[model samples]
Target: MIFFYTARAKFNNENGADILAWTNYIEWSKLTQLTELVSIDTSINEVLVETDRTSEEDWKEIVIDGYHETGFYRTLDHVLKKKILKDLIS
Candidate 1:
């Protein structure tokens, strides 16, 4: 199944460059925190993702196992993105 996620950074009155720089600096390892934040299954296949990056918005494709069997979509959204960013920064 195909899943979409919007990645965002929390910057205080920062310009586009700052935000984009912050996002680019984000590590992929930090993103794995979603497995617990969203309660994702570890048995899922290797994730296939497509990222559309821009200064303002960053959209990503996430492939998770059991996306169809479970209501996984319920946990994947803007909130999840915010949490990921938070986890990345903190």
Candidate 2:
């Protein structure tokens, strides 16, 4: 089975067909925050992603375990990179 998730920060276009970014540092439900971002950059952001479903669960574990080391997304700077910048307040 293949699963897809839209992350908060990414390099995507106006349609948001392609999205890529740092996903090793966030929660699952947090993906919703990227919607507005997808709309703003609906013109010039394209990202390529490579995935391995076999490790998806392990990936989640790693992210959770490493949270304390990197901390959480507390600043707008953390989530504003590509079109997603529009979704942020800062």
Candidate 3:
């Protein structure tokens, strides 16, 4: 059972003022609705997605199917990793 978190933004104004209010996840098979799938190479354990945001322009490609994504997507994973590591090394 795979899951992915999706950030939801709440707008305070019509002029684009908004805040990331929360996130949610769904099964991997259901991710198609949110993003456009580019390619999936099982041999290399790689899956790529087309950029849906202008901020992602610099990244020629993005791997959406991962336990920890490489960029902003890993924010929560990074925090969790720090906490787990602290406990283990303490």
Q: lDDT of each structure?
A: 0.36, 0.32, 0.33
> TM-scores for all candidates?
0.18, 0.16, 0.19
Residues 1-90 of candidate 3 have per-residue lDDT tens digits of: 644322222222232422221112224345525322222233212222222446443233333546544423334453344445555777
Q: Which parts of model 1 have CA positions greater than 4 angstroms off?
A: 1-3, 10-13, 16-89
Flag the better candidate by TM-score, 1 or 2: 1
Better of 1 and 2 by lDDT: 1
lDDT tens per residue, model 1, 1-90: 745443332322143334443344344345523322211332322222223245233322332455432312223564466555666777
Output the number of the TM-score-best candidate: 3
